[model samples]
Target: MYSSVDTIWTLLGAVLVFFMQAGFAMVETGFTRAKNAGNIIMKNLMDFSLGSLVYWILGFGLMFGATNGGFIGTPDFFVTGDYSSSIPSAALFIFQTVFCATAATIVSGAMAERTKFISYCIYSILLSAIIYPISGHWIWGGGWLSDLGFHDFAGSTAVHMVGGVSAFIGAKILGPRIGKYTKDGKVRAIPGHSLTLGALGVFILWFAWFGFNGGSTVSATGDDVLVSMASIFVTTNLAAAAAAVTTMIITWVRYKKPDVSMTLNGALGGLVAITAGCDAVSPVGAVLIGIISGFLLVASIEFIDKVLKVDDPVGAVGVHGVCGAAGTILTGVFAIDGGLLYGGGFSFLGVQILGVIAVIAWVAVTMTIVFSIINSTIGLRVSREEELAGLDIVEHGLESSYADFMPLISSEAATTTSTNDTNDTIPVKRVNSNPNAKMTKIVVITKQSKFERLKEALDKIGITGITVTQVLGCGMQKGNTEYYRGAPLETNLLPKVKVEIVVCKIPVSTVIDTVKKALYTGNIGDGKIFVYDVENVVKIRTGEEGYDALQDEAEAPSFA
Candidate 1:
């Protein structure tokens, strides 16, 4: 029997892999429009939630049960009846279920922003219940591929390749997202919403990947298992780091700037590439594989985007599908025991190529039929109107992911006045107004990164009446050509923050100085501040005019 320690280790690994669902969601959402964030989150959640149930009902049985004709498994449906007790059945099930879910979630990003939610859910179920498991069985479940000496230590082919290939097919069938291409077949760049969130997701995925490749050992017993686990951890991290550095250097040389989105995806590409041979390759070999994966990711993304004209918002196909297959082949070249470099001949390399080709054929054909069926029925993509407006409101009735960008202001101002009469009697009244205040509107156009600091400066100067809007414009640069997946995108408009502040009592010169100090970044995109003379202002609630309109109650509200 496998030791209890093995079971616990596998279970912990399952938990780590399961947590990757959140990472995938964030990465997908961050790489797409804020309008579709809720939809992305929903898809990630349901793929696991519904996928686990479906996999339990049929997928696990079809994958891990007794082999039938070396094609699929038979029996063990619903995980019932008498089964082998050699290992922990529950642990295996959980680990495999997460893998299946990972494959299902990958396609979501490629087809995001334009797919119908219902159509996506249907495809997700099909991928989990049939598509992924069947291919997975071929390699990992004692099927024909396993008999042919096909090796994928951690599912570079079984999971990443399958999902990536399926994503390519789905994206092709769904067609490019609206505004992705022009009348002359020129591909346009649709930038992601948040690099910070995308970077965070990449980091989380890096953390989870330790479990992904390490836990594939499925045991923590004996010194062999312990040693193999440690090796997997080091190799996995080395490949990812190598790929990140390589991608950064490549982007710097090619684009004259380090592209954050591509760099993050490069890290993932390295992880995927190393997944196939982390157990077999040396640290140097792993680094070599990672460097190749980085270059391959950049090249493949460019080819798929520019040559094939496929609109994959997050470069999912390049990162997963192309890199997955390459990584599997690299295993044959890097494996110490049977590697071609080790004088093991071309046998392992040939088998690796054969397995990759066979699996790709199976997944591509199966997914084509599945997607075709769905396309003819409820449809695969959303309407153009819905796509443009965003899926969050159309599908889930939620606000944009950037809902927090809108600020809420609450402040009060009290005015006091005195009147002198001819009879030497003076009457005083407490009024809410700012009669003598001079109001000026300061419009600061600066980089989004400087907004917070500018706001802090304004607050420090007792000027808090501010409104901010995200606007797109260009200055001397006139925007630049941004290459996405190698396609040149002429972006004439650049993103900037427009901060509108109305100061009644605060010095206009102070506000100007504060904004200038906060936003002077000595760069081309440091932004500009425009000061305007305000003729008048009025408060809606109180019949106050001028500066009074911008003021609020001086004291806090009391419930009593």
Candidate 2:
């Protein structure tokens, strides 16, 4: 009966863990360009599918089979023979499979936007089959790490650090995204497309982490087991919450505003840091752990980006690699049974450090070989042309995520072109206006967020037509500072929309008033509006000139 109960609990946890793959997909997609959304989603989907297949065939046995010489497992190849005499082998397999995939998927984000689909798929299989499972064997499968009194209760080292190290290696080898750095080595800020989706993904992962840490108990038979699981749940939630708050406060102080994306990553860092000792640490200890993890995440992100020069699109290395190693070491300081804070001595801390170093050494050497081979043979990164054009269209043959919008290149082109272009070949001919037949061109530069309201205001004023283009510039705000790994990246050019409308039938003052009413916010970036005298206007469709050209379908715009 106890065995059945444990099996049920494990299977439930496995399902929750499996759902994190979706969370990863959303987070990666949201933080990247819309042009690469389809490719991001596709890579995420395939990694799990490929990982599960490979783990089932070889990874499961390599991780949980009968141990040999305190190194790697030697038995239960293909999951044959009496591999499960006491528990439900199927439940164990499913639970471990999800974890294996999670580790493999972390690399996808770090090396995103510039990797070949085929190359990514191949590495995903290798990680699931050998890289992740072998190290998992060392810690969780009765191998050397377990034999040395090292405790990772829930895999800060086994899963997260493994993925984190791989992320660093992959990102390093693949190089930074185009335009991430200038010829002078100045780092640039590349903001993600959707903070809402990224935030949603963080929430989902936080919810799923309850199962991830709590279910590691792997049993629900006794009173002590139930109590432990409950405690683990509390610690996990407190740590995540504390880290998020800490990050928000720090970023607000440093950058003069709260950074939503970094705060989301902080929550993940807290979860990773606490995973190692969630079952053993008191709630107070968990809070301390979380606070420190948040600080570490911010600082590490800056250091890795600025010093190491690794371009991890999602900060996977800081959240997982640095935090994971730190969390494992902190477990030794917080664990109730043998923690230094509890009068245990430095023995456990030493063992934890040794275990971390061992795993890092093994993973780094092996991944270096794997990546070097792939980089040399089939190629690890996509060509510069493919990356600049975006992976979705060039690699996957798909349209941009927002199909209604013009191509991304067109918007970029509009930003750099002059607005003074006029075709002089055709003669300037005026039809309706003041006696002089003069015209006006109104150009408004404002926040993209205000575009809908501005357009509505124009509609209310009987203005029928206008053109808007996305652009980047600087003003009184003098741009803003973007924090990566703890480094401050100054962004001088910020995104804004340029709206242009030419009118001959309506007064220019009235058009300016309507726009000002729509976009006024009394802020530094409220934007500016320019009104230029237009000498001529010609309708391309009918060759109509001046006021006739301004009317649509032979209907003149209503004037104020």
Encode model 1's per-residue lDDT on 75-152: one tens digit a residue. Answer: 466888444343577778989999999999999999999999999999999999988888888898899999999999
- In the predicted model 2, the residue pairs found to clash are 301-485, 302-484, 302-485, 302-486, 302-487
Question: Which pairs clash inside model 1?
Answer: 302-485, 411-552, 412-552, 412-553, 413-552
Question: Cα lDDT for residue 527, model 2?
Answer: 81
How accurate locally is residue 316 in candidate 2, as Cα lDDT from 0 to 100?
A: 92
Candidate 2 weakest lDDT stretch, 10 residues:
426-435
Task: Give the per-residue lDDT digits (tens) of candidate 2, residues 296-380.
Answer: 9999987888777889888899989999999999999998889889998999999999999999998898898888899999999
lDDT of 1 at 201: 88
Candidate 2 lDDT for residue 384: 91
lDDT of 2 at 337: 86
